[model samples]
Structures are given as C-alpha cells and as structure tokens.
Target: MAVVVGSYSFLFVSTFVAALTYITYQLLSSYLHKWFAMKPVPGPEGTYLFLGDALMFKPKAGEFFRQIVEFTQEFRDLPLFKIWVGPVPFVALFHAETVEKILSNPVHLDKSFAYKFLHPWLGTGLLTSTGQKWRQRRKILTPTFHFSILTDFLLVMNEQAEILVEKLEKKAGKGSFNCFSDVTLCALDIICETAMGKKIHAQSDSESEYVKSVYRMSDIVSLRQRRPWFWPDFIYYYFGQGKEHDSTLKVLHSFTQKVIQERSESMSYGETGSDTNQGQKKRQAFLDMLLKTTDEDGNRLSHQDIQEEVDTFMFEGHDTTAAAMN
Candidate 1:
C-alpha cells in the first residue's frame, strides 16, 4: 500500500507539471503568433516580429532613429508598416500624405499617452501640453518667439557666444578637443543667461550640479517616454519607493525656484526701470513678457506658473540646441 501511494503521488505531480507547461506554452504562443500575423503594408518586406527587431525598437534612441530612417527608405512605397518593440505595436508611416494629415490635426491625434512621463518635470507646459490649454498657452507665448523678439535677443546671444569662444580658445591652445562637448556647454550657458537672466558658466564648470542633473533627467525622461507601460501615475509619483527620482526632482525644483525668486525680487525693486510706458517698451526679454501677461481671468500668473514656465524653457532651450549640435 505504501509503494502504491508513493507512485500515485509522483504521477499526480507529473500530470500537474505537464498541465502547467502546456498552458504557459499556449498563452505565449498565442500572443507571439498574433503579433507575428500582423500584415506589413507591402513595399520592401522585412521581418515583422523577429526578436532582434523587437529589441531594436524599445529604447528608441539614436540607433533606433537611424533604423527608422533606414526602414522608411526600404519601405518607401508602403502606406503603413508594423514593427514590434517587444510585445508593443509600433506603426510606421512611409508616405508624405498620411504624415501631413497627422501633423495638421494635432487636436484629433494629440501627443501619445507615453508622454505622461514628462508631467513630473514639464507640468503641462507648452512642449508637453495638449488640447485647449496648449492652444491658449501657444497663443500667449507665440509672440515671445516671433522674429522681431528673436532678432532683439541676438544681441544677448552674441554676447554669450563671445564669452564661450573666449573660454574655448583658452582651453584648446594647441591640442584637439571634442567640439561636441564644447558646443553643448556653450549652448547651455547662452540659454541659461538669456532665458532665465542667470549667468551659469557651464563652459568653465562642467560639473555644476544643476547642469548635470538637467542632462540626467532629460535622458531619463526620454527613456521613460519610450516605455509607456512603466509610466503609470502611481509608479512615477512614488518613483517605485526609491530616493533617486525624489532627489533629482529636488535639484530641478531648487534650481528653478532660485531663478524665479531672483527675477521676482528684481522686478519688485524696479530694477527693470519700466515704471513709465516708454521704459516698458524698451524691455523685451521673456521675463518682461511673462510679467506683463495675464491669465484667462485677467489675473496675473501665480509664482508656481512662472516657475513652471522657467523650468520648461531652461530644459527645452538647452537640450534642443544640444541635440542639434550633436
């Protein structure tokens, strides 16, 4: 009886293990086959659900962008091509008309939900904002970037550029150096001085905590956008129970708050010399425009709003130029 009982137990365990394996295989196979079965609009055919291609798509970094350009060229005649970034669906367009339609109707399509990762940093500012709030903010800020205003800011830009050149000449006496790093520092300094009215010598002090934090956060935010599943509100808000995200937020907030505080103090002291109408006309920087503007209810901007905008510009102005330089 003991021998029979032991044999029965072993048989039962084996049966259970086999059943579990079958179920797992079926589930994985079903999903994988479904993903594999997606039709690629025909032009230049390539592997659709291959593991290599899926791995290539996830980070969507420089290499992924290059892959996209190459894929577009190979599939130029295809209307819509499907690529899998892991299990996620990535639809690509190779036609001008379809791309134009999407761009023209931003209200209908809107930014991808993946962009929610930016909410912690940008806080619905122009770059990350959508729908009616975006429309209104765009209208208000459009004039600030107008050709006339940009032309005026050239003087400020040239002054900053001169300082950057002076620093580079000092460093590159006769040895070859990395132009990429040098230009990025130059751009950062110019944007900080011109955008926030703060002189951050990013060229001389590459180790500045604020500057380093900005770069780190920018790269992380871009990574987060590519992985939508990881950006649920609760997880990002809690930062998965770690202090890294919290510490980065503190650094960013401190830097922005300092800029706003100094600007507010300067305005209060009447250092702008804009007491008279004519004096006000002479001042045309972003800060001056922000101070003069009012919200929808004719109420002025709150300190928080001003800080958000300042942070938005600082991140956008520098990172964009840096990417372009690279």
Candidate 2:
C-alpha cells in the first residue's frame, strides 16, 4: 500500500513539475527571442538550453567530443557564434588567442558543476581536488609516476598487452568482434595492476565483479553529468536511484579494503623483512606512495582517503585510456 501510494505521489509530482517546466521554457524562449539582441554570425540557426543538450546532441557514445570539434570547425568563419543543444546556450570561439586567454586564466573560471558528479566516487583526490590540496597531493604523488617508476610498470603493461594479443589471436579468423570492449578491458587491467599493484585480470571475460562494477558506476556517473534532472549526490545516496552505482561502490570498496588490509597485515607480521624494505625502497606504485605518505600532523591517511584515491585512479586511468584508444 505504501509503495503504491509513494509511486502515485511521485508520478503526480513529476507530471506537475514537467508541465511547469514546459510552460517556463515557452515563456523564456519567447522572452529571449523578443528582448535579446543576438549578434548573428555564420553557423547553424538555433538557441540551446543549459541542460537540454542531452536531448538534441546526438553523437555516438565517445564521439560527442569529435562532433563538437567538427561543429567548431564548420563555424570557423565567425569570430563567435551561438549553438543550441535544446534550450541551452553555448558560445563557440574561433580565435586561438581567445581560447588561450581562457585557458591561461585558471583562477577566473572554476571547474564546472559537472565535476561534482565525480565527487562521490573520487572524493577530494588529486583529480577533483583544487588549490593547495591539489598542489600538495600532486607534488607528493608526481614521483610515483616518474619515468623511472613508469619503466618498472612497463613489464606489467607488456604482460597485460600480451594477454590481450593472445585473446585477439584466437579471434583472428573470426568475422568481427567489438574492439571497444577489448580495449576497455585491457586498459582496466593496466590500471588495476599499476595503480593498486594487484594483478586483476579485468581483461578476461570472467573479470572480477569489482572491475565490472567500476564500469557500471562510471556509466551511471557519466549519465548523471549529461542529464542532470536532480542533485546527483542526493539522487545517488538518498533516493536509492542509481542502484548500480551503489552496488558498484560497495564492491569497489570491498576490493580496496581487502588490498589495504592485506598490505597492512603483511607490514605488521614482517617487523624487519625484505618485503618491508622493498615496499619502502623500490618502484612505488600509487597505493604504495599513499601508504607511505603522512598528513601535516604526521598521521597516515584514513582508509577512506586511500580507497577514494585508488578508485579515482581506476576510473580516470581506465576510461581516459579507453577513449584515447578508440
């Protein structure tokens, strides 16, 4: 009875809200058309809404960025032009100098609210952290990815690459296969091995549930960013809306916790051993660096901090590499 009542209430509220939005949109469009003086330039004719781009910006997944670049080129004749993705407004700059100025003025423009969608997964890690925290974390973590350290990681990368090549060889004479899935899996393996120092075979068909969860969580987060109907944090946490996101997070946390716990246990048992020295001296992965690091007060990072950073690396490293490969 409660479920039915709640469902009806939600339906009623959603319908009312949508009706109001339609009315407001019509009014706003009419007002802009009449009152605003648009300096016309050569481009496609239309206006866009702030959040309506998801509805009209139809480009293949991972190809939306390329489409934007193409659109910009097509309008290169104009110094500045407007394009609408639904009712949202976007001004494209054709001049290199203008873009350079915007890029250089880092302090003037803040990261877009779209970034907040990643906050739950990444926390205030280097990728999402700003100002001093970002600087300090970056400074501390930079050496971990240095050329020397990356050289050590190459063996892991090559091993994973070999696995992928073997898999592809099996399908060599086959008609066709999804190259995207293959690349995505390979990238996940690389990220897991390098970042966490764990040899997770996410490239395999029978990949860990944790690895699959990361991909699912990423998709949910990306969807929320593109079509933000409600506050994402609230929707993700409170509304039980993003069940996949929640489940993925739990699995990811469990995996990270297990890693940290095992590492901690090893450290505890070997009070003075080669394993401890090796962890201390040579080839520091991201997690190794995090384990060694201490905060301003000489306190170790909380478990939450380590988990967030590890998760961030997994998401950022895998997706960006996959997209680049594609």
Candidate 3:
C-alpha cells in the first residue's frame, strides 16, 4: 500500500512538471520568434527580457491609459510600434494606411487573442466567432437586424433616452461631473429591454445582482487580458480571481438562461399579446425574433445558441453605445 501511494505521488509530480516545462518552452519560443520578426519595429527601449513593458503599466485605469497615450506619442512617427506584455506581443498601429491594410484583408477577420478572455461570459457569439462559424452566425443573425425589426427597437431607445435625459437634467445645474456611468446605465437598460424583453432598469437600480455581475465580469476579463500570467485556465481559475469570476459568471448566465427559458416557453404557447390593444402592436424584442428564426436548413437554433446571441448583443451593444454617446 505504501509503495503504491508513493508511485502515484511520483507520477503526479512528474506529470505536473512536464506540463509546466512544456508551457514555459512554448511561451519562450513564441516570444523569441515575435521578437525577431518585429525587431525592426520601434518601441520603448530598455524593456526587461521577460517582463517587457508590463512593469511600466499601472493597475489604475487612468494611469494605465496615460501610459498608453505616452507610448503612442513617443512612437508617433512610426506606422506601428511593438510592445511585449510578458511573452505576448502587441503591435499598435498608428497610421490609417497601416490599420486599413489589416482591416481590409479578408484573412484578418479572426478576433485577437484577448477576446478569448470574454469566452466565459459571452461564448462564441457573433462578436468573437471566426471563420465559417462567424459567417454562418452572421447569416443567421442578419435578418434579426432588418430595418423593420430595428424600428421596433426605436420605442425602447426613445423611452430609455427620455429616462436618461431626465436623470441628466437633475444634475444639470449642479457642479461639473462625469456622465459616463449614467450614460452606461441608460444604455444597459435599453439593451436589456431590446435584447431580452426584460426591463432591468439599470439606470434606476444599478445594485441588482445581474447589473453588478455584468460590470464585475467585465473588470475581471479586462484584468486577465492585461496579465499574461493569468491566461491559462488552471492558473486563472485556481489561483487568480477565480472564485469571484465564477460567482459573477454564475449570476450573469443564470439571469440570461432564465430569461431565454421564459421567452422560449412563451413563444411555444402562442401567448403573444401584441393585438390585445387598439391598433398598437407590441414590440417584439430581439429574443422574440430569435425564437421564431430558423437557419438555412430549416432547423431552429438550440437554447444554447439563442443564449449566446442574446448575451453577445447585450455585451456588444451597451458599453460601446454608451462610450460613443459620452
């Protein structure tokens, strides 16, 4: 019994070490290859061998952004500049021509590596899918955004916009302040209503578990994106920010899944009450339209598929629109 236990322990340690060594070698090799390929690119000098520019980055949001701005200004003359965040290489394009070259290329449709951090929260929805999956999803989702359908969303947009204006008007005569959060919550409310047929009223109640989970999950994903050491699933989930991430993810997924289940059941029973009023058509949310959509093969999307798209819309629409507005 003692010999068997010792053998198992030795085997476990051996396997662990082998995995660690393999990972280290792969990272080192990738760094060396990128270092050589991008050697001509101008970047900050005197970076550490392994740590690179990561040590210079601040954990604070404003400070981190300031550092990035400084870097861009320093390398403004160059079309592009490279930086190493640990073993990962990042190349920032400064010129429109340089950016257009990549953006116009069909081969460059795949999202960057950082988007993988969003997979836990969003799955491979339209925002993150690539290759044939992306094409298929785009086709499946294109009709959902038809002008008529978007017109229905106008009701939601107009209502949320009024609420936002009222909230801002309350602070109009007061001292100067940031309106970003207020705008973001308004956007969240609009997206929630338009996407899921549910009213989270994020502008009114931002303390709700779903609302808080959305922001917390974004923070966790952003932090992991910045830290290369936390890229591995085992390291991230077991060692760094794992418990908080899991809890936040559970809240988000549960809310989305519950809504999806309810919407599906509602559609199955033909319980839509659009015609109950006098000449006022009920606005179908994105979830409502998705429930009735079938793919090219006449097969309906599975529950998981619908959830992915709904969550993707929620993730993609809210923050970006808020940022643009603010």
| 304: Cα error in model 1, Å | 2.1
lDDT of 2: 0.70
Model 3 spans with C-alpha error above 4 angstroms = 1-27, 61-63, 273-279
Which candidate would rank higher by TM-score, 1 or 3?
3
Better of 2 and 3 by TM-score: 3
lDDT of all the models against the reference? 0.69, 0.70, 0.85
Quote the lDDT for 23 in model 2. Answer: 100
Model 3, span 218-316: residue lDDT tens: 778877777777888899878899889988999999999999888888888985422223787777888888888898899999988888899999988
Better of 1 and 2 by lDDT: 2
Off by over 4 Å in 1: 1-54, 57-60, 67-70, 73-88, 92-98, 163-178, 232-242, 273-284
TM-scores of all predicted structures: 0.71, 0.72, 0.88
Spell out the clash pairs found in candidate 1.
none
How much is 262 displaced in model 1, in angstroms? 1.8
Pick the lDDT winner: 3
By TM-score, the best candidate is: 3
**What RMSD does each model have against the real structure?**
8.3, 7.9, 3.4
